[model samples]
Target: LAALLAPGNFIVMGAALLLNGFAVAPTLTAGLAAAERSVVEKRKTEVLAWAISALNLGGALPPAITGYIIDTQGVSVAFVIPLVCMSLSVVMILPYLNIWREKVREIPA
Candidate 1:
């Protein structure tokens, strides 16, 4: 991996990390908020199941997709594919930003 980090690759890697961090940070935060908001005081088991299912599903999908892509293509191309996916994820999330904002606003002081 260190050898892969030559000057030319460094720039792209840096940009990819930046973009991924930006995309993931809010998703993680919103996911946490959503799980918290969805929890019911009396039905702890159901809420736990839902949250765990969500977390497990979210964790499972990306690696499988990326793994298939990498197996068919080469590593460099595989690495680039996530950037495209992350960009699309950002676009998909843009419309829901208002929803996230509303959730954030609901947080008690």
Candidate 2:
């Protein structure tokens, strides 16, 4: 976003945003669905609330951090902030995904 936006090309920015939105929709939906699946009946609301809160915070905080980077660094460089964060997130999630898969298998679907 910052990289494309820096060029001041509205058309490319708009297309990128549109495509990015499409890409993110499934990821966000899957996160929520996984949360729903993982929660217990008694704490469903609380768990969902926490999931939503985390989602909101995750969505909100990166922009501020990126914006700060954009101010200090150049826009192209600022995009590295999100790229690194996302890379770290994938690393962090890999273990949990394996655990979730094992648990799901144990459920005897």
Candidate 3:
């Protein structure tokens, strides 16, 4: 899906944004939930606060570089950063694939 953005077309951009919008709520909820669960009872509050702070910092930090890319390179190039980041993120998480599969879904089928 992130790859779809590389073309920088309106249709793909809208589709990507729509799909991302659907993901945002669940992702944010699960991320915070996982942070809350990963710590001892006492640090849960601090962890959540840090999670939120990181979200804010993540939100706040990207535009300068992306804007620079957009200004000098073009919007299409700017979109490539997400594709690269997504690929890197997948690779980074590959070490935990077994853990992910073990608890990926809990709902009974």
Per-residue CA lDDT of model 3 for 1-109, tens digit only, reads 5455365477777887898899999999987876676566899889999999989988887888789889998877875887787799899989987765554443233
* Superposed Cα deviation of residue 2, candidate 2 (Å): 9.8
User: What does the lDDT come to for candidate 2?
Assistant: 0.78
Q: Specify the poorest-scoring 10-residue window by lDDT in model 1.
A: 1-10
Q: Rate the local accuracy (lDDT) of all candidates.
A: 0.73, 0.78, 0.77
- Clash-forming residue pairs, model 3: none
For candidate 1, write residues 1-109 as lDDT tens digits.
3225654687777876788789977977767667576445576567667777977886899899888888888667775775787799899989988986786677664
* Structure candidate 1, residue pairs in collision: none
RMSD (Å) of each candidate, 1 decimal: 5.3, 2.8, 4.4
Model 1's TM-score against the true structure: 0.56
RMSD of 2: 2.8
Question: Which regions of candidate 1 are displaced past 4 Å?
Answer: 1-4, 7-30, 38-51
Q: Estimate each model's TM-score.
A: 0.56, 0.79, 0.70
lDDT of 2 by residue, 8-96 (tens): 77778788888888988798887777666675679778878998899899889988988888888887687577679979989999989
Error of 2 at 95 (Å): 1.5
Best by TM-score: 2
